[model samples]
Target: MPKQDNLSGYNNTGSDTSVFFLSGIPGLEAMHLWISIPFSSVFTVALLGNCTLLYVIKTEPALHKPMYYFLTMLAVINLVLSATTVPKSLSIFWFNFREISFTACLVQMFFLHTFSSMESCVLVAMAFDRYVAICNPLRYVTILTNSVIAKIGLAALARAVLLTAPVLFLLRRLPFCQSHVIAHCYCEHMAVVKLACASTSLNNIYGIFITLFIGGLDLTLISLSYVRILRTVFSLASKEEQLKAFSTCFSHFCAILMTYTPMVLTTIIHRFGHQVAPHVHILMANFYFLLPPMMNPIVYGVKTKEIRDRVLLLSHGKNF
Candidate 1:
């Protein structure tokens, strides 16, 4: 269970204070309790998986490199992203507590998109790491130095902040005079903005811009990196060398799909899918937030040899 909880203690919806009522899965309110079973379980698994990944990355000295450091950033971002949205959703489902203050919802929107963008930026960094390792092996270390990675991390945060901070001011200007009941669970950008009475042309424009900027640009860069990586791998003299080169990228490619596909689909569907049911949109939103967090470690562990070996050693009570 994660999401827009009493985080920062912003849940007082008094008669005077403006608050948003979250209608958890509009059409399936009756099934909330039942649905929360999987939600809570997935949340638990996501936290455990990411924590375990962090622990493994920390303890294994052999895993200390740019690739793993980018992975570490991804893991932390996954943890925060899941923490931002799932628990509150589960709370709403299980206990029928779906009230969230406007301030709290704003905080939720900020962090939700911030970490999501961070995840995207981290993926791009990972793509670049793979690119250098595959396409420019000799210069990999010099290109992805520790200080450089630190700069990349900071740059990611700065970019996310630059894009998402404006959302707060834009939201503050719009007046929610009609119903405060948001059809979905958390305070998603478009979802919250849709409840506004004023013109949301600016908000819509910004939302679309953020989606394309983060998802579109990052996807293009990653795709270019992989395309070059594949061309480099194919040029290797031996079949074994080609396989080895491609194997290194399998986990990262899976991560790219896990993260971008759902996010892009959700944003597109939200913008254009008028015929879709409310619960369907909400479920897709939940999946967008939850899937990557839960599956990332498993994908990495199973696909990448080092993490898998370290995890197995720890599981088997052996020195890692």
Candidate 2:
């Protein structure tokens, strides 16, 4: 019943019985390399994609609109998120489940959550930007000016910092047992907290609160913005204008689905289907954290004409 073998296929009784955690799964070293390959690959793509986005926004005067400003914020958040996890995850893969100190794990969890929450907030801002452009076209510039966009940026960063900073303090109060290994590829809050031997009611409660505030709040705002936008679009006198308005929001809508769907799926699986295969958790975790950023540039470029032209022009080294 050694602690290292906790949660493996061992005795499931007695105080000394190991819990056989997911870290004890055999051949994870090999699996780690497989996992790391995709992680590194996507990280590279995200870096290039988001950097291109930032560059296009910075250089192009025409791209200096509210929509592109919010897109820039999303790109920045994506860069941070990919940088936060992918390098550490790659290192862990090469090292074969290396032990992370409790403090470091907590720090990773905090960064991951903070960047994710910030991305969600930025997406909500993007939705609002689109709403203004489509529904309030005449005043879109006045309403979503540089000053207002700056304020929105500050608000998103503030929400993420305020929400995630407290998590570090909360984690500092929790004591880890001998079984300190985490289950997933990264130091996720819930997965790491599962290793705590101390009373975790407070941590769980606070985690739920943060999740709701970040995830639920952002999703609800985006939904409400779209509802108003749809109403206005339908009220347009010209069918062409209605189609154009809806088409303009398509990229943002795709981004929302890519970001939120995996999260909602993970929440449901972790709550109601914990008994599912470990591989399921691993797959969902990767998708939840990785896919959105990886697909963002494609979503925006393919669905939005301006982005597509910029990307094509950049590819050709043209001044566009």
Candidate 3:
């Protein structure tokens, strides 16, 4: 049980309590229960869906290609990202934020940014795979060998860790103000930073720079890769070949859009629409977290014939 529930009202300060006791925000209990249902539902679906994707790729020899390797990495990252937030979010909602320690929040934020950035890197890797397959088909095997793919995955992981380490390091220096209430459902970068009593100018600047570094850089690289892919597709002699090449990349494009669009929209809403409504923010938050993972498996299932068939084969007792 949360110590916050024992409190009579929001502003009550009589009782000395643990620093980590998640309390303060109004109507948290009701909000937590309300959000947990959908959060759990979507989290379960994402976990199972991504796990099935990993299994299909791993078990099916035919699916063991560079594209699927990167896809599996993406699935693993999403699975980890969902785990980092959903349980804590549920705890925050159901029992109040009393159980979450400052160290835990720092840890959670670190993992969240790490996984999210890694997903971006994986998307770029997938784009490179597509570029190679379409633009230099003859060299696909030479360029994207097992060793090369392993290097790419390792590089992505290292970059994610290095890029997000600052978040924890920088956050540790700030002192919390009196208001401990985070407006949103989770301990997001902005949400936690907002509680700082000290100067956050450097944090905000670093936050924006990091956002641009990860998001903008990856998007630019992916776009350039696709541009080359488009040229290669157009050069194909047959319409069927062009369509097939485009179809191969359609799901990836969809996944990219799903992942980044909400972020852009959320920024828009936060900057221009703060006073709009609370439910709107909640809806956007849920969509930001849920839509990409839920849609990723479906996109792959519908677009990639080999993955789709393998998933079906695994569903039944058929050999892949």
- On lDDT, the leading prediction is 1
Query: 1 or 3, which is superior by TM-score?
Result: 1
lDDT of 1 by residue, 1-320 (tens): 22443323332333434777787887787788899998998999999999999999999999999999999999999999999999889879877787788889989989998988899999999999999999999999899999999999999999999998998999999987766777788887887888777899998898888888887799899989989998999899999999999899989988988887788778777888989887888898899778999999999989878999998999999993
Candidate lDDT values, in order: 0.86, 0.75, 0.78
Best by TM-score: 1
Q: In model 1, which runs have C-alpha deviations exceeding 4 angstroms?
A: 1-17
Error of 1 at 25 (Å): 0.5
lDDT of 3 by residue, 75-189 (tens): 8888887788777667666666554557777887888888888899999999999999999989999999999999999999899999888888898888774555555555677
TM-score of 3: 0.90
Q: Estimated TM-score per prediction?
A: 0.94, 0.88, 0.90
Off by over 4 Å in 3: 1-32, 95-98
Candidate 1 clash pair list: 1-86, 1-87, 2-85, 2-86, 2-87, 2-88, 3-84, 3-85, 3-86, 3-87
What's the candidate order when arranged by decreasing lDDT? 1, 3, 2
Rank by TM-score, descending? 1, 3, 2
Which scores greater on TM-score, model 1 or model 2? 1
